[model samples]
Target: MKGLIFVELMNFMEEQFGELLTDEVVDAAAIPGDAAFTTIGQYPSAYASRLIGAAADRSNASAAELCRAFGRYLFCRFEVRFPTMIQRYPSARSLLMHVEAHIHEEVRIIYPDARPPTVTALEVDDALHVVYRSDRPFAHIAYGLVDQCIASYGEQSTVEWCEGNDDSHARFIIRSLHRSAA
Candidate 1:
């Protein structure tokens, strides 16, 4: 977890979720990212801040351990209210329970503050419509992944190439993925 992410998430609470938040909860939530932030992940700083918040509470419990416990609690079930998550994940705590993705450095720069869209489904037609935006680029890299995920999971589906979007995404379909224009 990053201080930036925690702060940004906190700021987003007011802006997007219409809620007041505490630093302690955010701090307790930052441990899982400690091992591979820059090399393999993007939220180390935020995790660190979360740990600091956790550490402040108990002398017997380390922030890391507290965070581990928090992680367990998060996955078990808690009400975390965030307005923008479409009512599925009600808060940051709840969002933490469900969403898990590795950020792409290329797109992360443009939407660094944003979390990747989790793919509940991929509806592919002339365009690649992803249930989770983070799963969008995979539409090009391997349509089979989308096919397997959605069809196997019973989502309406197809895999076809589209044009536009600064070529950031479409280019992948054409250049590396051998996708034909629709």
Candidate 2:
């Protein structure tokens, strides 16, 4: 994982939970180098899992839930950091459809060592089907990102997690709801 992710996670923890809780969580996780992260560096992915686990234990929230929330928060940060990439798409579905071929490609160009997940979106029966594949067990975070993306586009949609063959795979079905005249 890239250090940028760690830095963002730290920022998310501090902003949402507070500096005290963030410190406690980091201390509990016992990440190497005392949790000091540089945006351009790379670290063990396990550090991220441990931090999330510690935060979950302290906050009384499930790890999956925490990951999802973090994903949503992360998306907002991405929007602020990469406005041009986000602005190119008019809707969440549009952005998702090109995540793998475009966005992730751009990410790889900027952060050569970054290992991002494979996100592919397909349109079927008027709904968007997003497939997420990664060695890391962070599908819930992807779900959260998709959820927030839809909401950010001012679109009415429900995101559902479909079955996956294993931990490394997940499918999300996003269906837009059409509202009738009042």
Instruction: Name model 1 segments beyond 4 Å from true.
Output: 1-5, 8-58, 69-81, 89-110, 113-182
Question: What's the C-alpha lDDT at position 153 in model 1?
Answer: 28
Candidate 1 lDDT tens digits, 128-181 = 343323322322212333333233223343444445532113211212122333
lDDT of 2 by residue, 77-176 (tens): 8899899999999989889999999999999998888889999999887778999999898888898899989888988888988865344689999887
Each candidate: what lDDT? 0.34, 0.88
TM-score of each: 0.24, 0.94
User: Scored by Cα lDDT, where does model 1 land?
Assistant: 0.34
Error of 1 at 97 (Å): 10
